[model samples]
Target chain A: MWKSVIYKEWLKTRWFLIIYAAIGVLAVGRIFLKVQHDFTFNEATNFWYVILFQGYQYFGILKFLPALGGLIIAVSQFFPETVNKRIKLTFHLPIVENKVMIIMMLFGACCLLLTFGVVSLFFYGLSIIYFPHEIIHGALVTMTPWFLAGLAIYFLAALIILEPVWKFRFLYALVAVAFIPSVFFDDTITGGYSPANPVLFVLVIIMSTALLFSGYRFRKGEM
Target chain B: MVRLSRYFLVIIAIIAFSVVIPKFYWMAFEKPVRSPFVMYSCVENDFMIQKSTQDGLVRTDTRGNNYTREQYEEKLPLMYMRQLMISGTMPDTINGVFMDAREINDERSTFRLRTRDLFTPDPGLYPMFESQSGRANLEMPDDYFRITWRMEFVDANTNKILEEKSRMFSAVLYNRGFDFPAKSINGIPTTRKSIDEGYLVIDSEDQLFHVKMIKGKPFVEKVEIPEGLKFKHISCVDFRNKRYYAYLFSEENDLYILTQDDYVLKKLPVDGLIPEEQEIKIYADYFHYNIISDGEGYMRSQILDADFNPVDEYSETWPVKMERTEGKIYKFLFPGELSLSNSNSNYNAFFLNLNKSINWLVLSLILIVIQFFIIKRRNEKFKNQIVDFTAILFTGIFGFLAVNIFPNKFFK
Candidate 1:
């Protein structure tokens, strides 16, 4: 059952994922090229000074890519099911209704995790070529919140789309939009998320469970 | 389970609303409010103020005498010493104290330390620069050190840990009674200046220590923090005068100057200064120094002679309109607020600050009664009304929005 569900989601989202990956690479590559150009055209040690002491964020160009990718994939995966009333057939399958919802959410999460992870790793690899460990480490920690926000928006967009009522969907959208500011709150501050990281992890867990509640209401036909 | 899920979703929605409504109100309605600038007049031994009024910009002394800009500058001779010197109007003596131009220029330097409530903690790593570089200009070092239970320097070029120098720094700190796993550490690594005063560290026991690299060696000193003095912020002051090592602010809003002398802490005479929200400016001359702190609704100034004696003090205040507006809204809408960040730390954590609750409680009661009538009109059971009422009581406006949006239905 999990295999079929995974395959079905893959078939729906493969093209979108590939396009997002290409865009992510291009965005990240542009930042790297800019840094290389700075090193070449400007004084050599100036790049080191900017990266180290100035708290420059080389990966800021890729900030919105992950969140955009997550939202697109979530909508693409679930909107068709709702439009054609195909979600009802899936709910009536040989399984507990909530498990099916949970499985679907997990599939979206895993794909997003892989997408965000690959992009972050590529950024890390590129950073170490010209920058030191501390610089790369600070940049990665600062970027983690943005990536987590991507996963959060994915689950939230899915919940809002699957929700059966307009008023309730608007409430979900309001809540989701309110959380958007927190993603970019400390993105400019180097290593700013060091203290709030534990709290952030907890927020991610809460967001994942929020989808279950939305799914429960849909299954029970609550207005 | 369905009911539980609804409650869960409602709670999340309320939290989100609590974060958004206040922000939206402020973004739309906030207006600029400026406090008067207060400066102490050394010659007159009185506080002077410059402020905007319905008439125009007014300059007045505390004794109620209005003065022109030139008169105000003449009253603060030492503060306006540079202007006077450049204009060839140098005073021979004022308030019985003669001033020398070169001496004033050489001795006069000011350093400011403002609090950043939402900054990153030290990553325990610092780039150790060579104090006496053989080259004329100081260059960035290739190695950085991390202080854990011990100090370990890693080569930035090769990324290899240097075990020997790491042991040397660890031993020196241990000899000065520095503990392992530091509670907080701060450093000044920008070597654009003439001298390097490496790092200020607070150990696990909250003891302060000064560590610097002198000629590629460790110079460790245990700073003497006053007994029972609880400080909340520390910053290194690399002034050309070299009079003070750093500026420390206590938890009780007292700003202390940590003099270069080993055991000296000069507490500045300023009152009710919120370091996080205030801007401090210090003007120094050979005869006197003027310290001005501007907070949200008020500005305070203190004048001190060369000996740090209080010559005069002055202040002016106006009502902060933003707080008043927020206060009015809190009465109508919310019982309290949930804050994600505080003045001391920028971490995303939950903190509940309650405003006056009686009005909000009354408002919530009225709202819930209206909701009860609506449910009753639909012939819903009394038990179903209980969830909606309790939610309103607990979450105020957010609960009202949630229940209206996700109303419970009963099929007759």
Candidate 2:
């Protein structure tokens, strides 16, 4: 049953995923190329000094892509189903209804993670080439919130689209926008998110479980 | 379950509006409110306030008497001694002390101290540099140390923990009677200057310690803090003068100078300060030290001899525009509005600052009445109407906006 759900999600998002992967590669590759150009053409010592002391952030361009991917994937997976009332068929399947919704959400979230992971690994290899391990670790830690925001928007987008009522959907989107952007409150180059990351990570995970409640409402035909 | 979802939505909306609406309002309307820089002039034995105004840059004494820019410079001869010397306008003497620009520049010391609110958390790690590397120039260390129960130096290059060096520093600090985990620590890297005076750390017991890495070894020394003096803030001073190590502020708002003697703490005779809320600037020369503490719209300055004895003092107040406007708006629109604010720190933890405004109540009443008419037109249940009214009454404009924008489906 889970395999079928995975196949359905893949069919929905496969083309978009290709574009997302290409954008991720291009963006990360561009940042590395720019840094390498600076090192080659500009003063290498000044470049390192700016990174170390002046808080030069190399991974800033990658911050919003994960969120965009999550949002698009969520729309692709559910917008068609809701438009044709095909979500009802998925909900009425032989498996537990909430279990199906959860599986679908997990599938979308996993895709987002895989996309972000590949981009991050590439970034890590590029970072160590120009900078030391400490800087690379700091850059990666700062990127955690951006990726978490991606996963959050995916669930939030799913929750919003699955609702049958316009009023409820608008309200859900409002709340989601407010909640999702708070993850980006600290956009500092180094150590901004370290203090609140653990607690915020937990809050985001708990907030994602709200998908089940929204799904339960859709299943009950509340609207 | 539908009712529960309604409540959840309302709660989320309230929290969202609490942060979002106020933030947008502030971004649109907020202005920077600043007090003028106040410096004590030992030559005139009065405070010279330098501020920029709509008319032009103004320099004034505490009595509202205006002075020209050159006169202001002449008044603070010690501060402007070098300029005065270069421009051939040197005053013969100030407070019976001979004015020499070279000596004044060499021996003059200035330090700044500031305190953050209690909610601001420290980064919990510090990078100690090699203070006495047996070379003329100071260098940055390759490792940074974290203090848990002990100091663990982690190599910045390889990201590996130096276990042996960690144990060695831990044993030395333990033997020096520093509590294992430091309650508070502040350090300034010596990379800015030729000479390096390492870090000053305050332990859990409120004791002070000087720690530095000297020639690939930990150099630890205990500084005797005055008994019963509860230190609240530490500002490490790395002045070229090298007369003092750092400035320490106590819980009672008293300022103390930690001298270069390594054991003696000089208690400066100045009072009536809130460190977190005030901007303090100390200007020192061979004969006199001028300490200026400026809070919002208020400036106080004191001149002291070399021994920290009060020589002269002055204070003044002025009308602050931005603060007054913010205060008035807050009173008029946000009465009884419970906002989840992370006021002092960057961390987004919820804290409440509750105040009642009759203006907010009136605005809320107006919004609720309009909402009541709409709900009546839609034939909403009495319970739903009451819920909307209460949300508006509590959150004022934000509730009105939220409910109108996202109408409750249960009403239909």
Candidate 3:
């Protein structure tokens, strides 16, 4: 029964994964184009710095992409199918309601992970090509916190929309504001911006945990 | 709820560890030094100019030809050292004399000459001359020449002088071939212009003299009366020595003497007496010889003799008190008339303390609120998603930080 639910969730959002993949490929291609310029070793390093440091701001337009994708996938395929009346059918089919929801969530997480992985890979490749003289072996390693933060934001948004409580929407908006302040950490705050630092790492974890807890409360409270 | 609490504790622990550990490391190993001094040099030659020094060193490509450090230093004067101390450049060297000659006749012509001098020293440094020259002569129509006269000095690093000398040459011509009588005015042709105008007329045989143009008008005789009031000398307060001096000019036109403050026991004159026919003249043995008000609320004339002195003197109503309080220095109440507007903004200890406390409090509250939420949903799918997202984000942020914070550590 869990397998069936996961399969249904995957089938529903397959088109989104395809689109994300295409966009990721194109974005990565643009980064490669920049690498083709004739540059001194220092200039190349500076170019990579600009790409890495400013890439998030450029990608800010895509902030809504994951949340929107998650929302559509969750509302159309998961929530509607798991509505109070329809839930009985799913729960009674040799599987517990909790197991079905968990499987569906896993399926959605897999799709998100795939999308983020592709985007991160593209960034990694660009960094390598542009800063050939500089070592970028740790580029992906440093990106871990940002990737996690992005996923946390997406999950938090989905949870707020799905929650039974009316105030959850407001809470979600507050979290969004809080997220904005965190984004500015890279620019204004000295150590707050870096992902690799233990302090920022902890912050990412705490924010992620809060997002997850909020989602958990919504899921446990009602439909 | 218990599961949620566990999650919250875990997150708090992680954040605390991340923030605290690196800060400890930074404090122990990465504190930067206070001073990072470099040197620079400035030199000019026909082909190229380069300046380099031990502190604030700057090197530029001279297009293949390299200058040795020793050769560059030789051309520069010791007066430039003060300019270097203040991080200023030496001024350009453009010194020459101007000579004008008029023809009294083709072969025997009278002559008059006037010499003009122009030279600028390194801005902040005291200038010392090693050698200088100026001369004037004429070579027929359309040909004019001036030669540098011999002058040399080893400028005292401490004492600076603005010594300038000008000479006017005059002579009369007689046409011996035509039996023309020697041109004489009263006694001598050379004395004719001086006796008539009460001042010398500058000219040579080839150059003709005409009515002098004073501000575009024909020059007229203007009698000037010397005021009975005379100044002994004027000097600014030397903060380094905590003393003042008066520079006095003698009536006999002897050497000027710098007298100590004790020598001027009488109340010094506040206003300067100017010659009726001439503009107000303030004579001080300093670079900036401008009259200004001094302390005691009088519109007294003053001069900043040295580069280190304040660019301008305080106005009549400037405050004369300063004190230290709570480990910080403060200037006392200034007079309303004094211009203290250019002073730097005062430091506010209260604001600094308030900002620091607010930053810490906000950060702590954010941490606490996040922990509370994490603890409230440990077992939910949404909680897992949040954790997954956070893990990825934290990983990314950490990667970014590592790349930046430890560039040398990672690159190597």
Candidate 4:
């Protein structure tokens, strides 16, 4: 039953993921391309000076791409389920009410995690092409929260979409608007959020279970 | 399981509101309070205050004495050297000591250390320039060096390690008794300076060594640190006066300088200055060195003779932003805040600062009453809303906002 649910989610979000992966490659590729261009145009010594001393972020372009990937996955997977009460029919399956929704959300999360993982690997490969380990390491620390934001948005989107009430959806959206941008700090400080990275990962985990509450509310016919 | 799921959302919502509320409040009502530029004037033997206002820069003494622009420039000649020199009003001598622009320029250097500089991620690479390259200007080196098990220089153009240069430089360090795997490497690597003082690196054994590349050869100077001393930060300074190699800040909050006079480390007599939280300005001339540390809401200045002995000290205070009416309103509304960084730091840590004012309880009580009205109007039983009110009582407005946003239903 879970396999069937997973297939359903994959079928819904497959094309979005394909396009998202392409955009991810292009985004990460464009960043290194910029570094290459910068290296060619500027003195190598002065280039490192700007990056090291002036806090230049070569990989900063990848900051919002992961977040957009999360949002893309969430909207593609769940937005349609809310139309014409499609999720109600989904829960009418043999699986338990909460289990069906969980399986479906778990499928979206897995797809998101895989998509994000592949993007990160892409980032790692291209990062080493032009930068040393120190710079690559700094970009890795800075981008950790950005990747976590991808998963967080996925969970929060599932929680909001699976719920029955419109007002509650509005409330969740409001909280999310406040919550999501906190992860995308607006500075170029590298490893600035190292202490909060684990805590942010924990937030993503907690948000993963958020679907259960809304799933229960929908099952109880809260609307 | 559903209840616990709801619990998770509630907690996240609380943190969200805590950040959003204070952030929005400040965005709406925040006013910029200009802090007066405070410095010690050796001529008057008092602290001078320069404040910016609607008309122009208002200059005054700490004792409420105002002066014209010309008079103010004459008061602190060291600070207004360029302006005085431009107007041809420069005095030949200040305090009976012969002075010239060249000598004053050599003596003038400012050392600023902010918390952001110490707390951020180190790029772990430095450009080693020729200290005595005899060029008209300092030129950038083709490679950057990092210290791990040994000194490794990476070609800037290729991002590849230079094995020969690494071995050559590492041998200089090894011969000079530098332990492998350097701890903290500090240097001003920019080519903007007229001269390069190279790098002051601390080795694995906590030993200090000054490393420089002069005339295509490694020049290493091992510094003998005072016993039982722990250094917080050390940076090589390229002051034209040739007085000091670097400024060493100790863990004990003392500032020391490695003097060129036989590499002697002199502990400067400074008090009530935290480098991490304040802007330290050491304005030095032939007569006196004014060490001024301007903190969040106060300014403290210490006048030291050329020998670095403390002579006179002055401290002044004004209302910081948080002490104003807007801040008082913020405290009344938000019991605490979840901030990433503060005034002097950009480190993205989860910094939680709670409002300690007794008046913060006012908003909490008002919110509890509002929740009571909300529950009553919704025709919900009072007994079912205990947890909601309890949360509002303890977590203050943050919990109040969260509980209302996430509804709680119960079977009576």
Candidate 5:
């Protein structure tokens, strides 16, 4: 049952993944050329250049890929399954709903993670060539917030489309409003840029949990 | 469920309280006031050999030429720059201002004081000057003076006085150096002579007055000495490959260099420039050469060309010290090959406007709102989505103009 659910999600989001991969490759190539054109041989090894390439600016483009992919996947596939009563057939086929939801969520999340991994790998290669001495350890730590924020936004888009209720629409608006404050208070709005405050980590967790629970509640009641 | 609602209410209350309390306190308590009392100080230098123990006294020059200490005590009633609308017994001293029996508490009690020079208000009074202005001015011996002060402060009860507590002050003025110019070379007699120019003057504490004097006539004056201060010797040298003339003043181990043309003074690193071999002190306006000085009795000097620019350098030793009093001190051991001006491109001004927090916040919020409305219209199956988008865009533009653009234009 889990396999079927995962397969269905994969089938729906495979095109998005391919398009994201293409965009990621092109962006990385453009960034490399831009970096090479701007800096001389010695200056290319500067710490600021490495940070700009591997950190905020690189993550900024990476974040959009997930948001766009998540929106397309949620609106076209996830919503239709509920609105068209296709979820009813799946629910009645002796498959536990939670397991099915988890499978579908994991499939979507994997695609996002894969796209992020590819982009990061490209950046890592550039960093290695240009700045061998600079440590890439901070990149992993920085990318976590972007991943979490992207996941939260994806969950929000999923809940908004799947439920499509007036009251739930208001709740969705509230979720977006909650994110507005994070743009000012947290660095994730600017492509997962951050100062590594623990409070921001708690905020992301709380927001993500709220979105996931809302999705679960909508699935349990409306569909 | 009851507890959950109570917790939610508490959270809302906290947010509301945080937002409202600051605004309330700002509106109720924060009021502007015009500060009273304008205090200033002046230092005079006398270079003549006649004076012995008198090293020239530092005088407190007030804004209104109100110099007498006893008169300042009597006019303490009018010292308060503001008169409040409400009546009460004015405090004797508020923020070190001796207030007389006058008080007021109206909203219009604030008045700013206009500060002016005592001697001559024309061309303005500088920290260092030679002689007094106008023909009938009080004239005396050769000396220079600089004065600085702590200005007046208005009392909370609307009374003001020029009170002396050495805290909460105005400005400080002090004399710097003497101006003397010469057009001829040393010992060689040409048609050139010395110019004795008098610039600023002040009264000394010893009831005697001093003026700044330059030796020789107008065009060939080489030596300049302040009248009252005892000096060991004066030396003049052509520096920076004869681009400018430097007048050196030496007293004991200290050396002061003043330019011949403008009389601008600068202190030289004499100890670092000379090794233990030479006990003589040397001062120059511009030290264009490099000096190698070991602690032992050995010294070497390499004079660079006048057109050579100094190299930029970064220092790791002796961390950059930021102090309010001492200002910035940059210690450089060696210069770098590349200058900062040559390597870095000036940051584009495009980001200058976008760097403000308020602009980005408003833009993001408007975008979020427009996105919300667009999605809402689609949910309602509305055919005319352009109207909603246009309305939101117009409102956002209007809000931006009102909040950011209008106020800046009006205030600035």
Candidate 6:
């Protein structure tokens, strides 16, 4: 039963995941390519000086891509469930309805992890090539929030799309816009978000549960 | 499971609205504060004020006596020396001291300090320039240094450690009574300064040292801080006068200057100056050390004689945001404010600036009643929405928005 559910979700989401991974690779490649070009144009010392003293982030281009990836994955996976009440057919599968919903979301979560993990590995390799441990550590501390923001937005997009009523869905989307962008604050070259990142992480973890209510409401055919 | 999801949604919605609405209210209503520009007059021995008015800018002393432009400049000759020199109306001598623009420029300097200067985190590497390099302009060095377990320098060209130079510097540091690791370091790395004073570094155990590189040699001098004093921040100053190396902000909020007179830490007798949340301006002239602490709605100024004894101290207050009508309305409309960052730090986090006054609770009560009547009109049973009522009571306006957005149809 588990293998069947997993294979079913893969059939639904395989193409979108491929596109997601491609976009991740492209963003990482473009940013590091520009960084390499800039490193060659200026002396290595001068390049380090601007990043260290002037508060410039070389990986700033990767900031919004994670959030966008979350949104796209949610739309691809769940937007189909809302059409023609196709979720009713999904619930009819020979498993506990909520268990099936959890499986689907878990599948989407793994997809998100794989996509972002590839970008993170690329960042690690290129970061060590042109900079010292200090700049590399700064890049890690700075990207922590951006990656978390992407994860949070994914959970939020799931909750918004699973909701049965249009009014509530719009409201959830509105709230997401109002607060989620805050995680990606000013991209300082070094650490500024250390104290705040844990709170945001816990919030997103709690957010992953809110979509269950939307699933339950759809089962009851609430409008 | 359903009940838990509803509660979670309610809480999250309250937080989101709290973050957005109060900030939006202020975005529409906040007014810029107009503070008076003040400088101390050497001739009158009083603080001068240049404030905007309907007529024009009014120039007056703290004593309320007004002066014309020429008279105001004459009263503050050292401050307005260039203007006096440009007009050829400058004094050849004043108070038995010879006066000239060049003399004034060489003898005076300004240093402004903010909280972010010391508190903001940075990449832990610095380029040390040669102080006495015999070059007309300071040049950037090839390596960046980090003082961790021991001093280590990474060659910028290769991004690798120069093991030999690192060993040489660490040896000098160990011999100077320096502890193995440093706690805090502050120095300006740019070449724009008139001179290089290197860095003021506090060792792991609060021992202070002035570290500099001169002609390819290490010049590390341990500064003797007064007993039981610990520094929270050090603002390194490279004044052309060479009077002081830095202004030290102590953990107890005491301000001190590290004087060039054999590295003596001279304490300034002042209080209520928090280096983090206020803008501090220090203007030193031929005779007085004028320190101004500008805070949210008030500003305090003190003048000390050349030897650092208190000469005069004065404080003034102005109406701030909370004192205005728009801010009062904001209190009645929003229960709390949600902010990502503040003036003190740049990091983004959820900052709940709660309105702890009676006004906030009153507004919450009002919003509860409004939500209650709306639910009653919608034919939703009262007992079924106890959770919603509770959310409205605590979250006020945010709670009202959430309940309406999710409408308790199950209760109906």
Candidate with top TM-score is 6
* Clash pairs (backbone) in predicted model 2: none
RMSD of 1: 3.9
- Evaluated at residue B349, the lDDT of candidate 3 is 11
TM-score of chain A of each: 0.94, 0.94, 0.65, 0.94, 0.74, 0.94
Evaluated on CA atoms against the true complex, candidate 6 attains a DockQ of 0.61
TM-score of chain B of 5: 0.18
Candidate that would win on lDDT: 4
RMSD of each: 3.9, 4.6, 29.3, 2.2, 28.0, 2.0
Q: Alpha-carbon error at B167 in model 1, in Å?
A: 4.5
lDDT of 3 by residue, B1-412 (tens): 3244225523433333333333343345442222111111212322123333355433332343454444443333232333433554323321221111111011111111111000111011111111111212211111111111211111121111213211111111111111111111110112112111111111212111111112212232211213342322222222222222222222221112222323222232333422211122233321333333222212333333333242333222322222113111111110011110111211101011011112233333444344435434443334434443343233222222222121111111
Where does candidate 2 stray beyond 4 Å? Answer: A1-7, A14-62, A82-85, A88-103, A106-144, A159-179, A186-189, A194-223, B116-125, B318-323, B335-348, B351-358
Candidate 1 retains true contacts at a fraction of 0.27
Which residues of candidate 6, in runs, are more than 4 Å off?
A186-189, B53-56, B68-70, B408-412
My TM-score estimates for the predictions, one after another, are 0.85, 0.82, 0.34, 0.95, 0.36, 0.95
Residue by residue across A1-223, what tens digits does model 1's lDDT show? Answer: 7678778888888888888888887888899899888877864455656666676777777777878987988997888777866787878878887777777878888888888878888888887787667777788777777787787788779888988888778877877787666433532467767666666666676667666666666666766
Q: In angstroms, give how far residue A165 of model 2 lies from its true place.
A: 7.7
DockQ of each: 0.37, 0.22, 0.01, 0.69, 0.01, 0.61
- Which residue pairs come into collision in candidate 6? none
Candidate number that wins on lDDT, 2 or 3 = 2
lDDT per residue (tens digit) for residues A1-223 in model 5? 6777777777777776787678777877887776566444424323233343323343344445545655665555576676665765666767765556556666666676677688778878775554322224444444555555565566556655655356655644453544423332232222223333343355433443333333444555632
Query: Per-residue lDDT tens digits of candidate 1, residues B1-412?
Result: 4455556656666776777786576668766676776766667777778888888889998779999877777877766887777777667876676676666666677755444531444444667777666666666776777777788887755456788889998999999999886666665677676676677777877788888778889988887877777667776766666777777777887878778856477887766667777776676666666777777677777778877877776676777643576657666777676656655444445556675546788778888888888888988786856877898997788788777765665334
Candidate 2, DockQ score (0 to 1): 0.22
